[model samples]
Target chain A: MQILFINNDGGGFADQIKIPDGTTVSDLFAQRMPGRNASHYLIRVNRQPVASDAVLQPGDRVSFTPTRIEGA
Target chain B: MRSASRALLRLAGKIHSRVESLQPTCSDLLLPDADWSRCRAAGRRLEKAERRGWRLAAVRLRRELRQAMEQLRLEMHRIEDRLTASERPPRIASLREILDDLRFLPDSFDEVRWDLRQEMLSVTTEPIVLEGFPLGRFTISLDWTRIGFTRPYHVLAREPNPAASDEAVTHPHVLNGKLCEGRGAVSLRAALESGRLVDFFTIVDRILHTYHRGSPHSPLSEWGGVCCPGCGDRLSEDDLTPCERCESVLCLGCLSGCPACRGLFCASCLEPCAECRVRTCRSCLSSGAGCGSADGSECFDGVEPCEGGRAQNRDSEADTHALLPV
Candidate 1:
């Protein structure tokens, strides 16, 4: 299955990447963001906040936007 | 009920048209800043390896260095040619992607509105508290026409729960509704140029939620207090003072005392003496208006003390002393 991932942190790109059919939201985050704490990001599926273990679906639009970005 | 739905749809349609109108500029706007620092670093590393290889004078080591250099050379060549182009959404794809972003998360997003008369696109955020300081809700209003010119957006505090010290500053980076942007400048610009409404709003919201102690306009810890603008030390309103002349808020430590009158004033309130060149308050300067020495020294008219004694009282030493600042 392939899903559109919008990583609003570094690079700020929207990329389509293949994922396992049964991959959960946390699984996808772990693969793409490796080592970064999941709690630091506001993970959403199709524009709605979702549980960490929510199962991914093909053609899903997932965005991981950080809740806190410092301003000087 | 149906009429309200129709009105919302109409407003959304108008916003969609506004986004579509940006197609001509997107091509230029989406071009990311080129970063060649890594490529230069790689070249420097290769040079270091080559120098070490020459020092060893080992044939095997030299061969390994040559292979490494060759690989680096190829990579540099590609960079030189700029072969690694980032993926830019095609005009059609960008249109679709951005339209979705504009209307997406309506349930979660407090309000995404367009004021037709003002030509402003605004997104209201939920009340945001940072470091236990309630900054209140903010409206990130973007004037699309000014997007590339001036910083197009103003983050206005809706409820105006400003820091106690400075009413003009609502957030660490926001002063009088204008955001300093800081590190978020590039991404905010990119999102606006690409018509990514959600991303634009998301970045603004994040900035509101986060507070960096070192870089704040006024730190949240001092939200209920004020700081001396000159020295940046936290001080109570009673302890702090203002520049008498310009009314600049400052701490006592930064006060300047007039040499003549011994009265405290700010830099702007003090004038240099014409003779001594010492800064003095206006009342103490020798301006020739007040009684003083003939050469204008010791004049309280805010000018330098003249060496010559006052013409009216050269012999009368008592009067000369009387003109002197107490």
Candidate 2:
């Protein structure tokens, strides 16, 4: 039931990480990064939109992509 | 007998001359078109000229054959002369030392990355005003720097202010409702040092909230920086990810949306969600029933079905393998 979680801009080296089974996409993001808000990131499960409450199944893959904020 | 032989040879020579005379000249055949039918038709008008070519060639061949016969006769009449000519001079075999001299040739030169260093210099510093919401002004600095062999370009840096109760303008980690303000000079320097320069043009869409009603000049984007396709924000090279499925190379800002199935995909290769119609990676295809063979449509486009043009064709398997993967 291991799930693969990857973040492009995770601020650290582990761009790809494996989470335990039953881990949701939202959960993986929370575990990998403690303080960062999930709302700020565009979290996708298996290439589809998923709610934060949705639990991840075995073999599920998740991505944490950040939304662009504009400034000088 | 010699006279009759000469006459026969002369007749042969005449025929050969006629053929040679009938042949087309190189200039006459100047046109690139080599169609035999057109040339044949044209040859009707050029029968005499075209015949010259064959005649000349035949005459040349016959002359050579006659010369050979004369030579044979001479050899038979003068055996001593033939024997004397048969002796050959001894060959002086020797190895050349020129190759040894070539060892002194200079080796080719190339440059290594470590040998090069990037230099950064601040060009200008000034305060920039943004009249948009949560309205405020910040100090912006212009920097010009060169990276390796690349030409130098300009970058804009803005000071960050960390919001704190003490408001000493000294703290680095203060949040002003997602926009920290009033950070100290040292912390601000650190933030500036860490901050990456992004393109102003690409992220202009995001700054739509800040556009003034009657501004004469449009916002300018930084040159040579990669932009996020999704939000137009500038992305650092490391943060840039190219999608395997759709071939969209994007920054973290616009990295979502699989090109194949419109499914959400991350910078890393991950499958699309089961609930969504967006296309995901090859690994996740089996889990989603609709994918791979969803609604009976083909999972992959551009590739022909099992028995189309490529299926019947052979000898192209190597070409197909090379093209499809990339």
Candidate 3:
């Protein structure tokens, strides 16, 4: 299934990507942002906050925004 | 309520059009990105510069860090904080998506607003009280129409609570109305370029909500303090002295006392009297002190022209032009 993934972290970008039908929000986050703790990001599916185990559907808009972007 | 929602949708559309109309400039924003990177790198270098227990290298690196910050400031002045989606913004958000982003904001964000005519989208963050210091709420406004490759935003202090040491610095990472996005710049650009309005605002809000001790424009501990311009020492407001003449507040050690009036004044406000050569404030000498002779300015000292004064007081420039060997 294809899902729109928006990663609002370093050099933020959004692009449609192919994820397996069973990919959970946590799985996608681990795959895309390796070594990064999911606790730091506000993960949303279809513009609403979602649980880590929530399964993403095709055409779903998913975004991962850092909850604390460091300021100078 | 319908009207308000429609207005918001229109505001979102204005941003959509602006983001859509951007022409990627020939120049890449990498200049500032590089500058920003250098700044961060410079910060890190200081910590590692003296790992071998040598101090000279740390000093040199500190100077380099200052230079990098200066360059970043200069480059920031040159570039518009806009987007740069090379070939064109990818998959510009539809009006509905933009509206959805707007609607989704109220849940986590304090407030959302915009000006259709001004083409601006704004988010008012909840009061940012960092480390027990209330810096007041900030308004993060995005000039969506100015959207280029990066987000064009400015943060305004709604209640105007400024740093005690520097009024212009309302927040540690913010100077005046602009934010020193620092490490957040790249992510903000990415979100803006992709028309992820929600992400863009949230990222900025996160930046405001968070603080970096090493990269602050000004620290919060000094929020209630002042820096003495004379000695360059940080001091409380009561510890400073106000110059009697110029009214510039400075530490007492840097001030000079006038000989005649016996009053304290800044060094610049005291001039040496012509007669006794005493450093005197302007009020001590009569207004007519320098207005006596034919030159109108030569008659100094508020006294009768002395014997030596007559010799140098000759007004005749006649026969004085003996051309010397040049």
RMSD of each: 14.6, 43.3, 9.3
Question: Can you give the lDDT of residue B218 in candidate 3?
Answer: 65
**Clash totals for all candidate models:** 14, 46, 9
Question: Which lDDT value does model 2 have at B79?
Answer: 36
Q: Model 3, range B43-151, lDDT digits (tens) per residue?
A: 8898798776646568768867986786577455334333433433456677778878888888867887777777677889999988888888899998876676344
Mind giving the per-residue lDDT tens digits that candidate 2 earns over B15-72? 2332233311112112223333344444443455446665533543443344343333
lDDT pick, better of 1 and 3: 3
Where does the lowest 10-residue lDDT sum fall in candidate 3 chain B?
B288-297
How does the DockQ of candidate 3 come out? 0.53
What is the docking quality class of candidate 2? incorrect
Q: Kindly list the per-residue Cα lDDT of model 1 for residues B1-326, writing each as its tens digit.
A: 98755654554555556555653233223222232443354456656767777433244344444534443443343332222222454122254565566557466568877765677878898998887777789998888666444478889898887776778998877998888654455555555655566777888888787775545666576677777787777664545666666768777788887654456687778776555556666765545322234333455455434442244235456666788999
Q: Per-residue lDDT tens digits of candidate 2, residues A1-72?
A: 565453423121112345566666667777876898988665756545689888888656565544433221
Every candidate's DockQ is 0.39, 0.03, 0.53
Off by over 4 Å in 1: B1-10, B17-106, B144-150, B163-167, B221-326
